[model samples]
Target: MSVLERFSFNHATAKFWDQREAVEACARTGSGIGLWREPVQEMGVEASAKLVQDAGVQVTSLCRAGFFTDPTPAAIDDNRRAIDEAAALGAPSLVLVSGPIPEGGTIDSAREGVKEALAVLAPYALERGVTLAIEPLHPMFASDRCVVTTLNEALDLAAPFTAEAVGVVVDTYHIWWDPEVWRGIARAATEGRIASFQLADWITPLPAGVLTGRGQLGDGCIDLKRYQETVDATGFGGPIEVELFNDALWARPGAEVFAETRAAFANALA
Candidate 1:
């Protein structure tokens, strides 16, 4: 009865730039990985898939697909391609970061757009056996990155879709500050909507733009064990992915970062 099997490392943890090294590192650690789209595309989806398979690493989830706040036909089309890639990699879910409000548009309008986009792509995702995981970003990213800022909001958005086609990515870093987070986690479990569960510590005086300021495990003010306990209490036995977007960690060697991150993750769970 341990959370180790539930642990994974997001490629973004090592840095968004180094793709191959990150995969190899994850392989060395005997953990699963959360892959980003750009690297997969650059290395060629088939090649990347082969690399991961050869390394014996499980791909927990694909980093993204769902920036369709405008619900453009082209956006939906792109998301379809993302689903194809996720299926190709044998990943169970494609994490979706619902896009922000378009200029002159309200958040409500943006959310509606997300609904429409999901309607368009969810079928395709289901066909390919890829679950679209709507990731609720921090409220601070509500404007430019993702409007889905709370677990409740993400769950509400996903309520209309089948769990096979759509679900949610619960990242503790983004949601640890929410007053109603535990309730949301329980709700996700009851609804069977917990597609992915990730981790990252939160730091203050966030850097400018604030997208990459995530702290390493135990470096900030998050109660890591409480997260594990809460999610486990709900019978959510999914991979606990560590997805840090810290700039400093990115500057170090991938091997060092991987080892340190794995240790940090173990420490947090311990």
Candidate 2:
């Protein structure tokens, strides 16, 4: 099969799209999808699961379920629910964006909180046959969005746990700037810890808040083809999810955005 055959569209690429419509689009294109928790919960997890099953669309990975920067009991319980949802949807991985530095806490302390949270949830994830994919967000988000900011840091946090229960998410948007990204990918592959892979271009003059400034594929300076080859070299023949979080894209109709992104993905690789 062609590399594009494994293409999966992440729903967040068009944030306002209808969940069912997104799934239908994926099914129509023989593509997979990455779902978000809020929409899944809104539609009811069981019903959402049934929708994907009926549509014959694979749920590549759940958007996220990790904010245990404090590892509170409530936090653990919430994550347990996320794990259950992933299992029900037949999604092998639940992406985890370790929460930001807690109030009065440093980045180091927040990372420790992530460790504690993972320790408590790893067994639960293992039992459910779902991997908690620790996603290292861009360092720009370190203080308020995520403590984990690099593939190596994510791998280090996951090292204490079994690969089956804990792993890492390699998103080009987040790690493309790192000089050691190639080595990071190699190490992640060697350890069998690449739980999820996503693509989002790094755009310049980031937006005001910087949370929704992701550029469309081929719109930025990132070498998309190189990333594809690097990941493929690792023997990770899994779904390649496109998860652009751009405000402009989100403002457009989902169908339009999907078509454009699908084409962009093909072109970027070609």
Cα-based lDDT for every prediction? 0.89, 0.94
Candidate 1 lDDT by residue in tens digits, 149-217: 999999998898998899998898899999999999999999999999998998876766478899899
TM-scores, each model vs. reference? 0.96, 0.99
* Model 2 CA deviation exceeding 4 Å by range: none
* TM-score attained by model 1: 0.96
lDDT of 2: 0.94
CA shift of 148, model 2, Å: 0.5
Candidate 2's residue-wise lDDT over 1-270, tens digit each? 786789999999988999999999999999999999999999999999999999999999997899899889999999999999999999999999999899999988999999999999999999999999999998989998899999999999999999999999999999999999999999999999999999988877777757888889999989989999999999999999999888889889999999999999999988
Task: Give candidate 1 regions above 4 Å deviation.
Answer: none
Report clashes for each candidate as comma-separated counts.
Answer: 1, 0
